[model samples]
Target: MKNLPLGMNTLAKLIKQNCVYVDKTQMAWQLICQPGAFFLSRPRRFGKSLFVDTLKEIFEGNKPLFKGLYIHDKWDWTQSYPVIKIDFSDGTLQTRESLDRRIYEILFDNATRLNVTLSKGRDIPGTFGELIRFSAEKYGTRAVVLVDEYDKPILDNIENRDTAKIMREGVKNLYSVLKGQDAYLQFIFMTGVTKFSKVSLFSGVNQLTDITIDAQFGTLCGYTHHDLQTHFSKHLDGIEQEEIKQWYNGYYWLGETTVYNPYDILLFINKRAQFRNYWFETGNPSFLIKLFQKNRYFLPDLESPVVTEEILDSFDIEKINPLTLLFQSGYLTVAHTFTRRRRMMFLLKVPNLEVRIALNDHFINGYTDLVNEKIGIQDNLYTCLENGDIDGMLKVIQRLFKSIPWRNFTNNDLADFEGYYASVIYAFFCSLDAEVIPEDIDNHGQVDMTVKLGDQIYVMEIKVVDGTNADKLNCNPALKQIQDKGYADKYRGIDGVTVHEVGLVFSKASRNLIVF
Candidate 1:
């Protein structure tokens, strides 16, 4: 078996080093078959850079690297095109000045590599246009431009709206030159994590086809199950294939099949087949956590988020939708699709176990501020469910709610809403890797939350009372509703399953459980 290509992105280098390579040349050939600009959006570390490098090699006429590849015979190796590559996957760029400097530096490095002297005293756009025209002219063929991580500058400053917008405009200025250089460019491909709206970032280059979700190219960047079983079967011998699939395989793009993140699979095999959040831990999602709290987003909504096509693409620095952010960042994947009122809609879900656990853990931290206490809380909660101790479970939950800093409630009236409280509990249970079902359906009605652990099941109903009614504990509204709706009836007759119905009522004034 060939060695794993961990942290290796260059196709020539990977091939030379005898690394296991999932042949993507057929998809690459499809992309460059026509002379047009294209764009691909994938999460970071999804092998976009390596794919870009593969395209670079093909365009550079490196035929020796094409041995035994899918496009080996189909592509005309005699024809080589001038390739201009730009990668923005490096360190963060904070200010507009820094962004401009980085663009200049990238342009200079490209010019130096191609031995094309740039026009003196020209700005970023001018220099970029000059480079494309000169390179194409010198090589006697139009240039093929490839950009990797095209939106990193903007994403780096995503937490700061003003700076993010500034970075957006700066990159837009550099990309705007592409439309004018059409005559000098044979093909163009840009890859990034987020797909900024055409009007915002790619207004000048509206001709670029966004194949992010196009079915024809869905498996263009990630590894298919076939790729795994055919290539890495030896390395993963004796491992439970079903377990691996549950942990790291479920990313989809409306294709015939789903894909696994190459980074996750590679690391999982390299680390002795241990299942860890290898991909999720590489980058911090502090901004995303803050967005969730600031928006008071119901955590359960992510269980199966149904959004219109417009919502999926409605992303901008000024108006950042958390769902869009999550979807584009690989935290969510489309599970189903349908049409209503002539509008396309998508039903999305967390892709796999790794994302579900890690993402909820982050949200739990944001909601409860129980960084150090979370492990103890999860342990106690797990033990309570294992022992069927309802009172113990209630105390553990109450402790979590009390741990939230007062500032989390001061900015908004979130405490008055049942969703706020339900969301917190949902995050906690989900982070425990339990079978947590929010808005779980039954014959009679929908339950607020249901958690199944081993042979025990917990059905919970949450309610929030007004401040004036806090002192009056005369009503058991939450528990009464659960009983009246027969929310636990669905699982009561299961052979080995034990059902426990619990009601939690919170006060608007105190924001803690008043009745449990």
Candidate 2:
């Protein structure tokens, strides 16, 4: 078998080096066959760079590299076009000055590659406009412009609105030049993780078509199930098909099929098919965690977040909805959609077990403690539940709640609600990568939560004591409620499974936990 294409984004090199290729050239063919500017937004590390490089190779008329590819026979290999490519992933752009420098460097590199003279100007917008017209004039054909990570500068300074705004304006000026150079351009393709509204950056380039949610190109960058089974059968010798799908497959973009992150799959296959947090570990989740920490967005809402097109498209330097950032960043994906009041709305969710596990781990840290995630919380909870030490588990949960600074409860409007407590606990259980069902149902009515381990089931009922219930703080009403409601009945018939009943309570007056 050929070596896996882990971290290999150069299409020509990947193909020539005998790396496993999944034949996205067919999709590539479709993209270029159309006439118009196109934009694609995919999560970081989802092969956007590879796709951009593939386009570069194809337009450069590198026929030898395309011998067996779908576009080899279909494309006019004899017609070589001038390609001006700009990649924004190369440097730090924390300020307008830095952004100016980065844009100039990228433009200079492109101009040199195309052998075109650029008009000497201090302004990037003018230099870029001149480069396009000059390149087309010299090549006797329109130029193709490919921009990879076009939003990096803005994303890099997202937490700092003032810095990000300055950078956005600078970058906006550079892209605005593209619309004026339309006469000199053959095709324009821009890719990024965030799909900021056209008004923010691309209002001048009005012809740019956002294919981010287009069904036809949904599988363009990620690996599909068919791709895995057909091209990676050798690697699937011992790995369970269902397990693989559950771990990484389920990123949807408004189509029937779901695609898996290529980064996760390549690493999984290379590491002897061992399941792990491959993609999540490649980047830090701290920025995302901080977003939730500040907003106090309920963790459970991540499972079924509902938003309109406006919400998904609203990403500016000064304002950002947590859902938009999470969806655009690959931490969440389209679960499904509905037409409500004649308007399309999408329900977003964590894509798979990998995202759920990784996100909830941070959820525990950012939501509960904020001070320490290194407390070995995951391991301690795992140990407690595995040994059926309910008391230990309760104590650990109490500690998790106590780890929060006093200010969190007093300062945050949303943190004191019982829903907040339930959401954090749900996040804790889900972070274990276990089967945790929130708001589970039983014959009697509803259970607060249910979890299944190796051969054990846990049924829990939780409550909060308002000051009116201060006299009942020491009472085990939670246990009485669970027994009275028969919340454990759902697991009664399991032949070998043992059911553990847990009743948990938090007292507002005492600011503590009680367990029975």
Global lDDT scores for all candidate models:
0.90, 0.83
In model 2, which regions exceed 4 Å deviation? 370-380, 383-392, 403-415, 439-448, 452-461, 466-503
List model 1 lDDT by residue over 25-139, tens digit each.
9989998888989999899899999999999999999999999999999998899998899989889899999999999999989989898999879999999999999999889
Per-residue lDDT over 275-334 for candidate 2, one digit per residue giving the tens place of the 0 to 100 score: 999999887777787877677666666657789988876676666788888888898898
Clashing pairs in 1: none
In each prediction, how many residue pairs overlap at the backbone (N, C-alpha, C within less than 3 A)?
0, 0
Measured on C-alpha atoms, candidate 1 has an lDDT of 0.90
Q: Model 2: which residue pairs collide?
A: none
Best by TM-score, which number?
1
